[model samples]
Target: MTGDLILYTNPMSRGRIVRWMLEEAGASYETRVLDYGTTMKAPDYLKINPMGKVPAIVHKGVVVTETAAICAYLADVYAEAGLAPAIGDPLRGAYFRWLFYAAGPYEASFGDRAMGIEVPADKRAMVGYGCFADVMNTVEAAVSQGPYILGETFSAADVYLGSQIGFGLQFGMTEARPAFTAYWQRLAARPAYVRATALDDALMPKTA
Candidate 1:
């Protein structure tokens, strides 16, 4: 709970989501940017994340990989930031609900869609997300009643899920329903989100 926090990320990767969560958590951390296929696959980096993926974090000697896990870890450790509902808090159920929902169904469905991997109706039961329409509709409903995922308290769920929604919108993956558009707009206006985006954008690779 009291050690240096190190983030291994790339500006263009999902690491941006972890960066946003770090800013929201108000944690002091160092960042090491790993370029794809080089530093990312280097032996040293692989030790941190055997999968050799960006957006890993080392905190108090604990290594966390995967964007949602990293965000949740930061939120729990930095409880003072109030980025998660406390254990036993009624909202805690809903917090985990949407957080893992995004990490699992939303992520799976969106990735499949982007890759044009359709799940036939007969195979829908085997796939966790069921179908693209169901997944998107669920996402729409999740944000429709919200200024935040938990209705009011903005938690790390928003940081992870909002980043997914934001990315999906930017890349033309998600439908621009009014609810999603308005919800993303609200999250984009957060001070932490602004800072995180500016920092990452500054690190983007230059174009010729």
Candidate 2:
């Protein structure tokens, strides 16, 4: 594999999720550490991601931003590596459903709880997650049936959603339910997860 995958990221950020995904995809990538207020927001990087996000990626002259989008993009581009479910596969629906659910409602609920913000009684219906309890319950159900999120096959859904689950529990934004603990334990055994953790740890000091 060519080392043409360019990852623009900062240490101690959501970029770690993408790093784990790259390892899982077995994509040879080069990381470009971006200082928060400097290189990350500068012209060149801004051109790549107008929002000035650290976890963007550039490959084969194409740019992808957003952690979920990036993970899904890599899985599709490196399809031969089998990190994603094929387009017509029935499991693809399940993969996308959980992936987007994590990116949207799960994240929203996590943020809401972490900040101690409660949705207004009248506005609850307008909220995508509906209720934080729903988010946790759904996640618990999904992880309970898993060797991975997709069941038996560890897809990109596991990487993105699993990372969020890890962060939420680690930061005390969410509860440490039995299913979450079990799923995380299984995820910890993957070589990709280990390599990703080590690489990010090594780069942390340099970027910090």
Candidate 3:
């Protein structure tokens, strides 16, 4: 494993998710902490992510942004970590299914809700998630059969989607349904999760 992996992130942001992923992959990486408005939007960082976002990774001269994409990319690059199903594995389909589901519908639906924006019932067809309730119900079903998303196997899909589930429950964006709480409990207990979270927590700006 080369030490060429660089993670550009802010402690209080979605970067924590990638931190967890890197820890899970047992990757050797350097963290470059960027403040939200200043360093994050500066030209040097903008070259890394034009949108000026947190949680971007540069590995061996290649840049990857977007939380889900970063997790997926790292999983493939570090195959020995076994964070992904093999390409021809039957479970591969379901892996991509729930991974993108969390990135898309699950995130979109909850983002809209957090901002107090509600799609009209008549316009539900135009909205990808249909409704917040539908998204929540579908997510509940996905995790209900778990010890992990792929039954007994844990993968990058769990790390990415599981982080979203964790954020939702933490911030009151998701209800404390029995299934959601239990699933997060299982994921949170991971040593990787604990290590990643402790690292970021220590970097968080201290309050006066």
The TM-score leader among the candidates is 3
CA deviation > 4 Å runs, candidate 1: 1-3
* Clash statistics: count for each candidate: 0, 0, 0
Of 1 and 3, the candidate ahead on lDDT is: 3
Q: Predict model 1's lDDT versus the native.
A: 0.92
TM accuracy, model 1: 0.97
Ranking of predictions according to lDDT: 3, 1, 2
Model 2 residue 174 CA deviation (Å) reads 1.6
- The parts of candidate 2 lying over 4 Å away from their true place are 1-3, 206-208
The 10 consecutive residues of candidate 2 with the worst lDDT sum are: 199-208
Candidate ranking (TM-score, best to worst): 3, 1, 2
- Candidate 2 residues 138-182, lDDT tens each? 889998885898889989999999998888778777689988878
lDDT of 3 at 186: 94
Q: Please report, as a residue range, the 10-residue window in candidate 1 with the lowest summed lDDT.
A: 1-10
Residues 7-42, candidate 1, lDDT per residue (tens digit)?
A: 999999999999999999999999899999999999
lDDT of 3 by residue, 19-128 (tens): 99999999999999999889999999999999998999999999999999999999999999999999999999999999999999989998899899999999999999
